[model samples]
Target: MRMKDPIPQFTDIITKASKLNLAYLHLLESRVMGAEDCEEGERLDFAYALWNGPLLVAGGYKPANAQRLVDTEYPEKDIVVMFGRHFISNPDLVYRIKEGIELGAYHRETFYTSSAVGYVDYPFSPKYLASEFV
Candidate 1:
C-alpha cells in the first residue's frame, strides 16, 4: 500500500498557527499578477487578502510595481513584497531597492543549471557597497 502525502497535515498545522496569530502567511508564484493578463477581479482578490492580516507577497515583484500596489491599493494593510528572479541577478536586492539602483537582468539560460553559474555568481551592486566604505 502507498502512503498518503503529508501536505494536508502541514497545511492544517499552518492554518492552526495562523488562527492563533502566531505566524504570518506568505504567498508566492512564478509570475506577476498582471503579467499573465489575469482578470481585474482576480488581482483585486489578491490585493484584498492583505487587509485580512499580515502577509508577505513574493514572486515577480519589481520595485516600482510593488510600490505602486502598496501606495494605491493596500495602503492600510500590512504587506511585505519580495523578489525571486531579480534576486538571482541581484544579490544586493534589498539594498538596491532601498537605494533606487537599477536591478540586473537574470540569465534565463543558467536559471536551472546544476552548477553555481546562475545561482551564487550574481555580483552585488558596487556603487551601493562603495557608499558604505565612505
Candidate 2:
C-alpha cells in the first residue's frame, strides 16, 4: 500500500477544485484502517496546506483529539471533525461526549448487512436517556 509521493494526483485534483471556490474539503483518516487497527497517526498537513477553506475530517476520532485538532493544531483554520461508525454505535454521541460518558461498542459484523441488524439495533445508554438532554 506504500508508494512514493501518493498525493501528487490527488493534489492536482484539489488544485483544480480550489479554483472553483468549493465550500469545504472532506478528509477521511483513522487509527484503524479497515479491518486492521493501526496505532499509526494520520498526517493531513498537506491537505491543510492545500485547502485554505473549511475542512471536515472524519475517522476514528475521540472527542478530546478532535477538539485538540480544531483548537490547537489548526487554530487559525476552520476544521470540523465528523463521526461515522461511532454514531451508529452511540446514538447520543453528542451528549455522551459532552458529559464525558463512556461510549458504546459497535458490532462490526452486522455493519452494512443490507438490513437494520447493526444499524438501528444498538441499545442506548440509560444515563443519556435519563439526562436532561433527553
Candidate 3:
C-alpha cells in the first residue's frame, strides 16, 4: 500500500476548497512513510493533508513547526495539531495542554493486544476532571 507520491491532483483540491479559509492536514498512521526523524518543516503537504513525523518521544512534547508555512502571504493559514492517540485517550487534551498539566505515558501493552488491559488502564493526568477522582 505504498505510494511513490501519494499527493493526488493538489490543484483540484485547492480549487474546490478555494472559498474555504481553513484546512486540516490529516496524516493517518503515516509512520510507515518513515517521517519520524525529520525537521518540523521538512515534510510534504499532500493536498490538504500534511504527513509529519512522530508526535511524542520519551517524555517530551516535540511540537512540529507548522508555523513555518505561515509567511506574510499565507498568514491566515493556521496549522492545528491533531494527535490521534493522545486525543483518543484524553478527550479534553486541548484544555489540559492549556492548563499545563502532565500527560501520562500510554499503555503500550494494549496498542493492538486483543484485550482492554492497556486500553482502559492508561492513567490520565490529574488535570483530567472526569478521571480526577478515580
Candidate 4:
C-alpha cells in the first residue's frame, strides 16, 4: 500500500493493534520547541489518538516540564508518562527526580571522546548516596 501521507499509515497501524488488543508504547522525540506552536491540549489530543499506552517523551523535557507532564490529566488516566534525555548526564536521575534536585548539564564535547570522559565519568550526586564505610 503506497500513501503520500504518513499520518494515515500510522493511524492504520494503531487501528490494527487496537483490534488485536495489543499493548504498545509511543516514544516521541519532537522537541519542546517544535511542539511549542501547538497548545498543550492539542498536543495531548494528538498523543492520545496515536497511542494510549505508555508515552515516553524525550528531547526537551526538563525536570520542570516532566513534573507538569506527569500531573496533566488525559483520556487514559493510567497511561504511563515518562521523560528521557535530560538524564543522560545525571546518573542519579531517578533520585533527583524524586527529590526534585537540579540535574547536571551534559557536556557535548566529551560525548564522543575516545576515553571515558563523558560516558561514565559523570559523578553521582552525593546527596543521593550514603557515605562508604571505608
Candidate 5:
C-alpha cells in the first residue's frame, strides 16, 4: 500500500494547517495503533518539527509512560497525552493511575467480538468501587 504522500505535498498540507491558527493539533502517531502495535521506532518527527503549538497526541498510552512522555519527550511544547484502549477497560482509569492501582487487563481476542462481553463486562477496581460507596 502506498501510505506516504510526497514530502512536498505533505509539507504543503502541514504548512496550511500551521497557518490556520488552530487551537491545537491532534496527532495520531503511528506508534501504537489500536490493539495492534506499529513499527518499533516510528516517531512523528515531521509533525512534531512542524506543529509548534499545543498537541493532543493519541495512541496506546499507559499511565506512567504517558506522564514520562510529556515530561521528557517534549517539555517545551504544551502536550496532552490521550488514552484509548486503557480507558475502555478502566472506567476509573484516572483514579487508578493516581493511586497506583493495577489496571484492568484488555483482552484483544474479545475486542469487537461481543456486544456486552468486550464492551461493558470489564469490572471496575474493587477499591475504587468501595471508595465510591464510602
Candidate 6:
C-alpha cells in the first residue's frame, strides 16, 4: 500500500515491562507534537526505545492517558509487545518465566550501528566465568 506521508502508519504500539513506563511518555509527546499534524487515518505511533548498555540505559514505554483513551477512543485496541535487545540474549525469556539469572551488562562503546562493539563483544556471564578460571 502507498503511504501518503513520509512517516509510517501504525495502529498499535507494543511495549514490554521495561518499556511500559517510557512508551506512554513518548506517545504523549507524539500526540502533542505530531498528532495535530497527522491526517484522519493517521494515528501517532509510539514505542519505548531500548538499550542493553549500562544499567541506566534501560527504558520503558509509558502511553499517555492510555486508560483514558480506552475509556474515550479505543477500548478494543491493545498495544502488543515488540521487545528489542532484551530478547536477543534472553531468547528463552518466555519459557524461563521466573528464572532469576543475572543478565550481562552491555558496553556503551558499541551501542550504535557502527562495528560490533556492544553488539557481540559484551560477553555474557559465562564468558566471565571461563576467563576467571583461566
The global C-alpha lDDT for each of the candidates, from Candidate 1 onward, is: 0.68, 0.82, 0.44, 0.58, 0.75, 0.35
Model 5 local distance difference test score = 0.75
- For each candidate in turn, the TM-score is 0.67, 0.88, 0.47, 0.64, 0.78, 0.28
Tens digits of per-residue lDDT, candidate 2, 8-92, equal: 8768978888999889999876566667656465677888889989999987788888888899999999998997888999988
Per-candidate alpha-carbon RMSD to the true structure: 7.0, 1.8, 7.5, 5.5, 3.0, 14.3
> For residues 31-74, could you state the per-residue lDDT of candidate 6 as single tens digits?
12232322123234332223111111112212223334434454
Give the best candidate by lDDT. 2
- Model 5 residue 16 lDDT? 96
- Model 4, 1-134: lDDT tens per residue? 22355556667776676666555555453443432422231143444566655555544566676556567545343344454444668888878877777888776666556977776778777787763421
Q: Per-residue lDDT for 1-134 in model 5, tens only?
A: 12565456666778899999999988765555555765443456677778889989876677777787788877887889887767888888888998999888776677777467767778889898889643
Which rank order by lDDT, best down to worst? 2, 5, 1, 4, 3, 6
**Count of backbone collisions within predicted model 6:** 17
lDDT measured at residue 51 in model 5 versus the true structure, 0 to 100: 84
Candidate 6 Cα outliers beyond 4 Å, as residue runs: 1-80, 88-98, 127-134
Better of 1 and 6 by TM-score: 1
Decide which is better by lDDT, 1 or 2. 2
Find the 10 residues in a row with the least total lDDT in model 5.
1-10
Off by over 4 Å in 1: 1-22, 29-47
Is candidate 2 or 6 superior in TM-score?
2
Q: TM-score: which candidate is best?
A: 2
Q: What lDDT does model 6 reach?
A: 0.35
Q: Model 5: runs farther than 4 Å from truth?
A: 1-9, 31-35, 38-41, 132-134
lDDT of 3 by residue, 1-134 (tens): 35565456544554455555544333332432342322222234444333232222111122222223434323444544455555545545666666655544554435677887665665566556655444
How does residue 129 of candidate 3 score in lDDT? 62
